[model samples]
Target: MAEIVELSEADQQRKDLILRNLQESLGVDKLTKQLSTGKNIHVYWGTATTGKPHVGYMVPMQKIADFLNAGIKVTILFADVHAFLDNLKSTFEMLEYRVEYYQRVIKALLSSLDVPIEKLSFQLGSSYQLSEAYTQDVLKLCGHISQRDALRAGAEVVKQVDSPLLSGLLYPLLQAIDEQYLKADGQFGGVDQRKIFILAEEQLPKIKLGKRWHLMNPMVPGLTGGKMSSSEIDSKIDLLDKPNVVSMKIDNSVCVRGNPEENGVLQFFRFVVFPIISPRIIDIKGQSYSNYDEIVESFEEKESISAEALKEFLKAFLIGILTKVQDKCENEELRNIMNHAYSSPPELDTSELSEGFQTVLELKDMGGDRMKEIKGDCELITSAKLYQKLNTDEPLKVLWRVSAKGKVNLGHLGGLLQLKRLQALKCECSILISDIGGFLDNGKCPWNALEARAKYYEEALKQFMKAISLENVPIRHSRENQYERDYTLEMYKMASKVTKDASAIVEGNTLATHLCPLYHALDVHFADVDLLITGEEQRPFVILGQQLCQGIGLPSQAALLFPKIPGMNGERMSSSNTEQHLDPLDTVKQINKKIGSSFCEPKNVKDNVALDLARLIIFPLHEGKEVVIKRDEKYGGNVSFSDYAALEASFAEEIIHPSDLKPFVTEQINALLEPIRTALTPQSKMITAAFPKVAKKK
Candidate 1:
């Protein structure tokens, strides 16, 4: 049993403010003192998957630390089962790997932060069972609520797409039930999860369980905009990022000019780092800072609070935490062995391209002339300033080369000026050669030149789709209109087709080979599309795509879509060769170390144009039935929309006018997500077929 400690008046004030902010933002009430009465407060937060715990995980971790500092009993729950449900990208083996990874990472994070790990008891979600008594209590309570209200509340609890998986719908209720099972006095999460706690409060009393539940939520914003997310790479910094990586990410963060109220970096500072560094003071020095301004100032000044300085601070902070965690993780070797007791046999390799393929020019004189011409054109186009500008600020330099045999070699092409554009040749009739068909046939076109290109592209597309799906919108591109349109159409078509094929396979009890092409096509579309929309919007669609694929029993290649944190040479970090990379542990150490030294600067107007476009053109399409506020002559004004596009465009123009879409967009998103509340309702006996119930206790 954990003991509770008393807090000083100042500490209580800080906790009160934090709790108040959380309640206001999330629409939940503060916890009673009973929940906080334990001397050792144990609050656990973890992802469903073991992929690197992103910034979202930090929210709960920080809360635990705060509670610990306040002399409360703290218990950290890994929620491994929940991780498996949420992180569909992971294989069972990968899931195991992630569990270890998180255990180590989290421990490291805590240790680095100088948090007291001794008082902390880390437990996996699966370790605790839903005892028959607990289920009976839940069912008895379920009987008290009307089915309509149950459905409505249950829907709100999950707050995600309606899942056919019984567990998905029941999970929230189960989470609430955990409070009773653990005899926890309180629960904590981000503001987004306030509804769940509310539902828990309503149902627990109905079941005759103690009504003494306390809920605490933190306000954490995304790095680019909106909410901080584990899935959105740019929105939140990974604790494992290298210093350079963290610095680059911060430099690219979204920050509004004149009004610093909505800057992502500042939000991070206010919600995450500030509480750790200076909990009582909302403003530093004479500057009146909110969550956003703190980060902006930190990045703007390269001195103590500069991007480099902050990165170093975070890096050191994280490294210290992880080091301590690593020490604890090593003690679980026996548990690790037990977890692997029923491992599956290794998969046999069946790749025909193991030896790889040769480049078009390498394949004798099959299409040598056309290959040379195309290669020359590629080089010229790559060197053009316009083309380079179209690609990246770093210039459209070639980062890697694929040999005829599909062997990848790293190199850099100096500038776009060195390359010629084949499109230019297409404009002149004299330059049009019939032999150009040879280029296509011999794989001389850029599309076919590299074996890994499509793979990489597909990976990027999947990531893009996942990002868009979360926000429920199509991705927008500023350039290459035709390409973007074609890619979007292809993606939707692929999704529809794959969904149909997957249904057929599931119904017929057939294997899923037929669905592979659709999956591949969808993947390819995402990759090609991502190149065009990389920095424009938070790619929610990519995350959604991964979830969809996983739901449909397809492999989610999410690992491939993670943005490459460029190496010192401006090339993506690679582990393929000895000279190019360090081992995983070393890489983790380097990232942890480097992240501390880096700093994140706020994004300027010109840099965040894409995010602006997304807020304007894309976001509204998914607004569903949310009401929009309009100023009018009669009774002020309220305009609601079923047309997402019109609403999105209107909101973009109105709210994001000259670059301020944070408030409007977030408000609309909250409305759009309201329907998900119904999905969280507790299922009744009529729908009890959805879940496999545990037998009643003897």
Candidate 2:
């Protein structure tokens, strides 16, 4: 600032509008002092011609509107040289084409916003930055600053790499000198360029150029919940996207109601929409409104808004506003400029181009390269070999060991739900109730209680399969099967085939717990399982099964591992924690209350029991149908998701609130358990025999 100078009332108002909606401002006193001198303040906003413009460009465009409305002189600088220095994102041959593409599109966007072109002008960075005086200032400023400081300045704007090009280091240096050469009173940009703004303010004084007012707009996150990049197609929506394409991009984006400021859709309303359109908003009912705070209030209150409704509003606005831009691009010359400039952008941060299917769960190949997938959850651990095997013409023979001990909880139900999913893919599944094998260390089931407990487990399994619409799957008890005549000879053959004793962990007081893993492994042989389904914690038994089969010269079975279900307390669910899981026989009130009380942290997918229930149970059951999440009218109306991936993505991004998530999961779980709870009512005698005094007390 030159000095303290008071502005007139009219110029004061102009200063306010120029500084509105900025995340940070530097040297505001300079603008006020200059405004008081009865002269129009000059401000410049620059853009590098690296990628095609997107909806994110609206932030700066709206800021430019504010400046024009304030009656200030604003210059829109197309930074062609800066773009070329940014790892050569724009080649010299295409710079002219890209610059032309930028000029046509920006003018169209500003015209659509009704910003007056009377006081607005355009400049190319090469026009002034190429002059000898500017060249002398660049070298003079270079001698005053270190390489580390220059790297720190452009760290936010440049594409970082191990050994960066010299052009990247000079990017921020040239931007600093651009302020003096453009002859502007201030530089306006996104808050992302604050580092360069600070450098221009600090290093410019060494060359004797005074500091200018630097204004910044809040950064709007990209569509997929990160910094929007032109190289990443899914993260940003292009400005020239068709109306239908705009709807599709906004529809596929995941949003939740956790933080109103962090959501890309909500931030769009605050930074771009509100400033241009004022408080006017056409809500879901198509009614006119002067107030739009209802969206933020709903997100903060008991009833949160639906992600679908808000996205629809943004979709309509974007489509309508882009109509002018897209329509103007239909000109023959404009189309030629776009085709020449963007025909072949360098592959920066793009997904691999592949012919075969990408791995859905981030699986790796034998060469250790990460495989891409169209979609998957956090629990998918597979290989190309495994994928090939599963897609073969042979029908899969799957086996799962059902425990005939303790209360049957949702943990058991989750595994069976996966078994139900496999049946649709020609899997012939067999449930082996392991009565003679591993049992809970608890005293609920003893040797005398084996028959009644096994019977109880079978009834529970039948009801679970029935609830998932499964029928006629084979069920057998391991104790009964072990007594068959051929089993005696098979046990003798199995004992001689292993490399070492399976009793390595037979220490005092926990002998059964150590030997249980080997016992479960041998069950694979008895069941003739071609593919095994179990929790990933049971992987040790699968490893032992492979060794046993190798010693006996039988083919080893492939394993499909799933992470353990999270408990109500947000820890691993266990039989030891009695209240941590929902039992199949729980009453409707109990089921709802238990699931509602489960820990469901907002935007935390890994530790949320509600999300696990949705991903593992609710979604798998509703495979072909849409899962509708009921929302209050105060929030948006109900929203339906076709697949769990979309739902999980929304939840992870906070587009889905935990409060809404818990209730929906509770409702689905109660419905799934209703029949199971009813079928187990008549079998009270079996529970009494299996659990003794414990069953009555619970």
In terms of TM-score, the best-performing candidate is 2
Q: Give the lDDT of residue 458 in candidate 1.
A: 26
lDDT of each: 0.41, 0.71
lDDT, residue 656, candidate 1 = 25
After superposing candidate 2 on the true structure, give the runs of residues whose Cα lies further than 4 Å from its correct spot: 1-4, 286-293, 345-698
Q: After superposition, which runs of candidate 1 have C-alpha atoms over 4 Å from their true positions?
A: 1-47, 87-96, 137-159, 162-165, 258-261, 279-698
Superposition-based RMSD of candidate 1 using all C-alpha atoms, in angstroms:
28.9
In model 1, state the lDDT of residue 20.
43
Best by lDDT: 2
- TM-score for candidate 2, residues paired by index: 0.48
Per-residue lDDT of model 1, residues 1-698, tens digit only: 33454666765664564354344322212242333343333443434543456655655666666667655666666665554434233334555556666666777667656677787776666555333355344434433443333334445333344322323333455567777666666666655556566767787875667554454556577768776666677776676565566667766776544434576655556566665655354434333444545456555553334444444444455444444544555446634643552244344232211112111222335233433543542211111122223333222221111111111111111111111132232211001111111112222212222223323222232232332342222222211221243433332233322332232221221112222233232432343321211111113333344444334433332211122332223334232332432212123344333322222113333223233323333333443445454444454355555554554555445532322233343343333223322322232321232222435758
